[model samples]
Target: MKSSFFSILQRIGHAFMLPIALLPVAGLLLGIGASFTNATTIDSYGLQPLLGDGTILHALLTVMKSAGSVVFSNLPILFAVGVAMGMANKEKQVAAIAGAVGFFAMHATISAMLELNGLLAPDALPEGSLGMSVGINSLQMGVFGGVLVGLGVAALHNRFYRIELPTTFSFFGGTRFVPIITALSYMFIGILMFYIWPSLQEGIMHLGALVNRTGYAGTFIYGFIERALIPFGLHHVFYIPFWQTALGGSEIIDGISVSGAQNIFFAELASPNTQQFSVEATRFMAGKFPFYLFGIPGAALAIYHCARPEQRKLVLGLLLSATLTAVLTGITEPIEFSFLFAAPVLYVLHCVLAGLSFMLCHLFDVGVGQTFSGSLIDFILFGVLQGNPKTHWINAILIGIPLFPVYYFSFRFLILRFNFKTPGREDEGQETKLYTRQDVNAAKAQAQKGDQVSNLIVAGLGGSSNISHVDCCATRLRITVINENLVDDEMLKSSGARGVIRRGTGIQVIYGPHVTLIKSNLDDCLHNAV
Candidate 1:
């Protein structure tokens, strides 16, 4: 049961990575375009005023804004494709195509159901229904709807993909059967969703209201739970709805409606009335900036200073890159994972302190937004670029003053008093060797081709007979084998894996962002080998 739960949670996390990876570029485009096009920013930064209307730079900025906005606008389709690919064990293309068909069919079916129920409208549904806008005879189900359609297709595709058909129906035996099965299943789902979604939407609205009413206390809880759930890989399920659904926060800007706190903030920032919205509406994102930019790096310093003197040298490089990752990109897994396995209690303390920081930021009305992590990059683009009148950027410094020391000293005191392993103090038998990006790249170069890398990875994973399933997330190759004992960790490392993780029959080979290509190559190699 534990293994099954872990497997499911891991797959969800893997699915999230696909959409998550695209956010940084989108965010950058939005930030740059917003800053350049804003009259205030352009004037303050001394951009050419005469070039503003119909000029090349203005046209370019318009393109930039459209590029950024389109990603969020069409997020539903992206989620559908991402989730389908993430969940598929084989023939990712089949699952993705089926997921697309299922998405449209489900929305159409839901539209028909709602029309029959007399609840449908042209531009909006009755209150307590999903969708940002209404269309002819139907409303868009948004990202939440996309998630359901994707999961449905994946389930159907996985179960029936290999089923044998009678000779007369052999042409539709394999991948061809996936979309047919998915579309049929989703018709039933559409009917069910039409009835269930209203209440579900109402519940989500009430929950959002409760959180909003709680104010800073709500921010604290959100920040704490978001970090706390990372170990179990369930944080995305908790936050994405709040980030994308109407329940999170929504606003109609410049004759267009945008949902989610982040989306609303960006829309407002790009519009002339960036300062018009309530700062409190941005409470979700505001709380995270201080913790990511100040508190996490301090925690890293504490861990490093307390490490065994001899081993400190060994961990210094790890600590540096991990600290930079946390501060710049808001990616804290490297830093958090460093201490989580070594000192679980300390991890909880970290979460609690993070929660406190969130509350403090909200209490001070520090508003900021991020597409990815709450890193320095977002702090500058979202908070600083928009100027202090809107986001209260200086309040981050105020919150960070006490917040940083609290994380640093608390971590230090606990590590020393309890003699926690932290990182450098681990037992001799535990795997202490760390691999860097350079190491992975070198491994890749040594192999020269993806096939060679895949071959080595396959050999390391105990080859075709041993591997039961193969899949990948953003940065890791998720594989399951009949027997874990047959896997060779050294061979995997040499084959370009930065690290190897094992949980029962499940194994994940870490290879950073290039993992998708490696997974594709590995799939091909496995096919040819068989």
Candidate 2:
């Protein structure tokens, strides 16, 4: 069951990645359109265009804006299709159709409820009157709604795809049943949303307002909590306030507002309303630029320098990729996960740095927002379109360069001082020795002797029965065992694992990138043993 859950999560990640990868294209289009508009305004002010305003430029701007608008408007549809396809095993087309059906069903259902509520007089209606407004469209159509649609579609597709039908209704058998089931399911979902979505939305807005009222301290808490909640996939809950509602968002339409840290920041950039506290509240995010773009990379450099002589090159390669990701996209998972399961103290340090960065940015009033986190892409765009256009964002980069080195040296010194077994710092006996062909042959000969090394590993961990779940990512066998303490580290090491890690009630065995294959082998071993 644990493995299956992880598998679902992996599929969801893949689904989300597809649409997310396409976002840069949307950004480029929007940027170009904004640039064109700027150029046109400048020309109107009697400035001669180096590249004259021809039909070509005008046409290109129109196309880019149109494309961007389409992408922005249909994000929910894109999400549904992406998620369904990612989750489906073989019949992607069936899943896609189911996704579409599910989306429209929820949309129609929500629209109907709002319309119905509008018909009833206030005195005759329930308190809050369902807070349902017709033609109410949310930014990105709500991630939760998209996920529900995808799950609904996938479930229907999987369950009804092979169901036999009466001869008269045979046409609706198999994949065809998906859309029918999806439409029906959404009616119930719509009714639930009518009663629930308003309160949830208001609650989120209240939370955002509360955070805003806390000022710099609130921003610090938000940043720290966001990082800490990552392991449980609950970061989204905290992020919703900054991204979805009016409290932390901007008034885009006539009466509607959009909130989220990014939303608020962008709203401030697009239209600065100094009177509104929400717009001014975005200063909290500005301080994060230096830390994400520089400090994390600096920490990576420290890890590389502190690595054993033989492992320095390997560590450098890993840190390089991780650093590049942090700088370009603000995706710090690859870097964070490196020491997160090893030297937890460093992870805590990262959390501290993150909080401090936000506080400093808020103090300096240097603000920018990104779709992801504080990465180079968001940094550049936000800098160019800043509310405080006179502020020197370049200074943030200048400050970051030396800061990176400081982080590196300090981390190296601390790790050495504490004798922490971070990555390559393990004792000689615990070190992983790579095997050549000759060594493989020697090990094979030893295995031929009455030495069941694999069985010993299983036994040391309280046998196959003890393993409640097993999955993996790039470098570790993520396992949920009956008792984390039952797993002997020495036995796992003898079986060729690089290391063992524990978090809460979970245990992870390091097997590098090949951990996936190891997880499969272990699963087979367990099943056969049972």
Top candidate when judged by TM-score against the true structure: 1
Per-residue C-alpha lDDT of model 1 across residues 1-530, encoded as one tens digit per residue = 56555666677767877776788899889887877787777777777664376779988987897799778667777888788877887888999999888887777887788777666554356433445422424454567777877777888889999988999999989999998888888888878887787777667668778888887788889889988976655677777877777667656677665666766776776688766434556676777887777888788889889988888887788788777877887767767767776688989998888788778877877777778878888899888877887788889878887777888999999989989887777777654434356645654574465557878888898888998888776457877787889999999987755567777677777765457667777777888888
lDDT, model 1, position 412? 94
C-alpha RMSD by candidate, in order: 3.9, 7.3
Model 2 off-target regions past 4 Å? 1-18, 39-55, 84-92, 117-141, 229-241, 244-250, 253-256, 263-288, 308-318, 384-406, 429-530
Residue 167 accuracy (lDDT) in model 1? 98
- C-alpha lDDT of all candidate models, in order: 0.76, 0.60
Candidate 1 residues lying further than 4 Å off, grouped into runs, are: 48-51, 114-137, 254-257, 276-281, 308-314, 426-435, 445-466, 472-529
Q: RMSD of model 2, in Å?
A: 7.3
* For model 2, the run of ten residues with the poorest summed lDDT: 125-134
